[model samples]
Target: MSLARRSLMEAAAARFGWRRAYGDTTQVDALLTEQTETAYSEAADHAALATAKNTDALHLQPCVLDVRGRVLGDALYLEGLLSGARARGLAPELIERLEHAVDHGHELTVLLADTVRTTTAAHATGH
Candidate 1:
């Protein structure tokens, strides 16, 4: 599920139903997933049989989001968290961005951060 969709569902659950919300969602998700897999299988088979050729296989790629954009986005999210904590007179133990990067380890993090920075720079330079 997408983050936005999950957030909306969570908000709805908080505002409306109290019980079995996730349980209901789980059942629905399972059933829908089963149905979708079956449909895709049938469709793929029919296409291949009709064309008498191998169907083109699509590959899923891993996505690396921009570090700066993600950091700025997290800052915006902290505004929400901090505001909520302040309203309830509580101090939230939020993780700092540097700490998060460090937690991912040195070598892997360098490569990941490089990818984000490279992409952002490329986009900025209109490449």
Candidate 2:
């Protein structure tokens, strides 16, 4: 993983209450890289299979329909955190950027979860 992605993941994890399990930078970097690569591979495999079956549109229909609901939930979650941070009188610019990042993270989380769930279901049903 690139330094930027690793940093972003670390920050997002911290924001979401994921503690650092490894104290050393080397260990943390290795873990993050491994986990990210695994996730990417899983997502790619899911996408390839879905494409091969021409099921991408069908699988994504729910997400497309619920886009607004998902975004609103993510925004409210982020806004609550930002409001708390702001109450502490922290830097406004940093809070704004963090809120944006959190929203992006939420989207990624939802997409990844959907892909994983779809792939798992396909495998279980021998699809």
Candidate 3:
């Protein structure tokens, strides 16, 4: 993962008390998928922010896992950005900023997850 993303994830995790675990990538992936769908759908519907409910399930995912579980932390950060934007009463431009933040977080999570998975696979194969 890029250092910037990693740093952002670490900061977000610390802010939210996410425990880094070694086996949470799958869950994190699931959360990201859900968040991505929600964000896209919400944008498609052009829903007003005040009336919109967040992709609750994605936000509720457990973040207190090992290094493997840190994907959920990234997902949570993205969710927070979305929720924050919505909570701010949805000024059009602010909403756009929130969307960008969430997208960035998702990209970082994917990179981190890929790295974790590759490293784990290499170790398993005794590379």
Better of 2 and 3 by TM-score: 2
**RMSD values, in order shown:** 11.8, 10.1, 20.1
What root-mean-square deviation over C-alphas does model 2 reach? 10.1
What is the TM-score of each predicted model, taking all chains together?
A: 0.25, 0.44, 0.37
Clashing pairs in 2: none
Off by over 4 Å in 2: 1-35, 53-59, 66-71, 102-127
Which pairs of residues have clashing backbones in candidate 1? none
Worst 10-residue lDDT window, candidate 3: 56-65
Native-to-model Cα distance after best TM-score fit, residue 11 in candidate 1, in Å: 9.5
Question: lDDT of each model, Cα atoms only?
Answer: 0.55, 0.73, 0.64
Model 2 worst lDDT run, 10 consecutive residues: 56-65
- Which run of 10 residues does model 1 get worst, by summed lDDT? 54-63
lDDT of 3 by residue, 8-56 (tens): 8978998998956546888678657867987898875655542365243
Top candidate when judged by TM-score against the true structure: 2
